[model samples]
Target: MIGVLIVLCSLHTGFAVTHTGKGCVTGSTGVRDLPEFVAVLMLDEETGAYFDSKTRELQIRLEWALNKVNDSQKYIHYFNVLISSAIPDLMNALQFAMSLYGHSGGIHTLQIMLGCEVSEDRKAGEFMKFGYDAEDFISLDISTLAWIAHSPQAGIICADWNNHIETAQFWKGILENECFALLKKLVEYDREILERKVPPEVSLLRRDPSSPVTCLATGFFPEGIVVSWQKDGEDLHEDVELLETLSNEDGTFQTRSRLTVSPADVKEHNYTCVVDHSSLEKNIIKPVTEEEIKTNQDPENSLPVGIIIAVVLAVLLVAIAAFAC
Candidate 1:
């Protein structure tokens, strides 16, 4: 089985840092036997960017203002370096951590989150954690690497490592001296752009444009948008499937809401797709028309019509042949 390594970074108006990297190794049988691990360098509510190791492609494009900054390139270069250097250690740590769990091969996840939150008062709180699935194996706070929390038995091993004083000290130093340093600089540099909010361009689409239509609301921003199908004035919940929100290349988001409707319902009912987002002062409503529905119906659904026509032709041919005979 192939492993996936994902790296993410985001900076928000409050200067919060959310940097996380995760790697998962799977067994040959497509089972996850090796531990999955996530390492974070920073947390926040802003749109984040993803870097695919295999493709080496950045999913989100940099804002124009960000592109104009000289340090932006330096920042991106540093991010690349951090991910490259940390991934190996994270993978090794995952393998070692998995071994300690007494399992050679199975699906397990290890996550590390490194974060810094600065209050309006200029006081900063830094946080870091190492966890397996939902269980926190170790946690630390502040620049001194003070032990704030840990798992019951896992705390023993964590404490031992802290006593040696390298791991915790390293993260504390990096978070305070390096990560926060960069965060402050980047936040100040991109303050205007970071504070600016761009509303998404909402588009309603049909999967088949016909009966049993799947409605898609795409190109929304800030990751907060409501998409639903409605009949008349009431909302629809039955036969509705809402897919997960997907991130666009521009850091906006897209989601799909599917509705199943019959031909009779299309003719009698007024169906609409309603979208609400922070960017919009009022909800955007797109009505579904009968013509649109009929125009978009699946071509496969016309198979019965074709079959009927063929049968009629065959019967006419048989009658003609009999008369001539």
Candidate 2:
């Protein structure tokens, strides 16, 4: 019996190592390219980002399963591979990727790597909000895939939506639990900001005390909201700021927020922005400023509230659109 081990090469790519699956040790393709008979599970999410030890475990699980299917144990053979990070449309994403693998008619295996849990109303902007602000700490990507069950010649491993460490003991429990909590915070915070009648200034930026991240956050609330940065929850940027509180095309009331920090604050304080709004249940996240990010190298970006939701919704529609809708 040939043994096949499919390892996750990166966020959007996987490699198939076969020893017992067939007379193989044969298919060793480059990372960016692949042979015709192998199916690659590309994990695009973890590729550019740093996944701590816990999330890395999830990737490993997917790797183990990939090996099983390709081994001589009698899963499908002679299929190509499709690698991607976030599935734009679960079904469409799956189907489209599979077409490359030659299993488009009805794929035997469909896997998902879930990093965040979303409410029914998940959107692109909201989906990306956490990823945007999650400097090296925020959780916005998948931790692992689960193979719930299978048949004689086939099986399935996917993203477990109802992941629970219940008491602990969940698969890769540490990664799933913490990452889930962080993503939820983003949704809750956004909803609060949206509801505020007199929403205070809000800025979301990333400044690493270890090393600053130089990426400007995009503010697209459609509410004419201004955003900036702070340190120790204190406001930043006067000489080093871009204060732009403009009139909306419709001319409503949008509050101003700025993001700024000093070298001392960056080195010593845990500064964050605090926007006091009448509509929000509480203050939203303390955002970073341009200066804070300018000196930093691994600058974290914030995803405004509109885009992530759109991407997630699109992906949901593709996978089980009928069920999703």
Best by lDDT: 1
Off by over 4 Å in 1: 1-88, 106-109, 118-124, 143-145, 162-170, 191-195, 207-210, 291-325
Per-model TM-score, in order, reads 0.64, 0.20
Over the stretch 1-325, how does candidate 1's per-residue lDDT look in tens digits?
1113222223233322322111111111114442232222212333223332344322223454345446665665655554444445445555666667775775655555445544442426665555564466666765566665465556656566556566557666765665455555545655554444456554444444344575555556456678888889898889888776665555455666777777578779988878887678888887777444333422221110000001111222221222122
Candidate 2 weakest lDDT stretch, 10 residues: 17-26
Model 1's alpha-carbon lDDT is 0.48
- Per-residue CA lDDT of model 2 for 14-107, tens digit only, reads 2111000100001121223322122222212111111111121112222222343335222221111111222223334334334434553521
Least accurate 10 contiguous residues by lDDT in model 1:
302-311
- The runs of at least 3 residues in candidate 2 whose Cα sits more than 4 Å from the true structure, single-residue gaps closed, are 1-230, 233-242, 246-264, 287-325
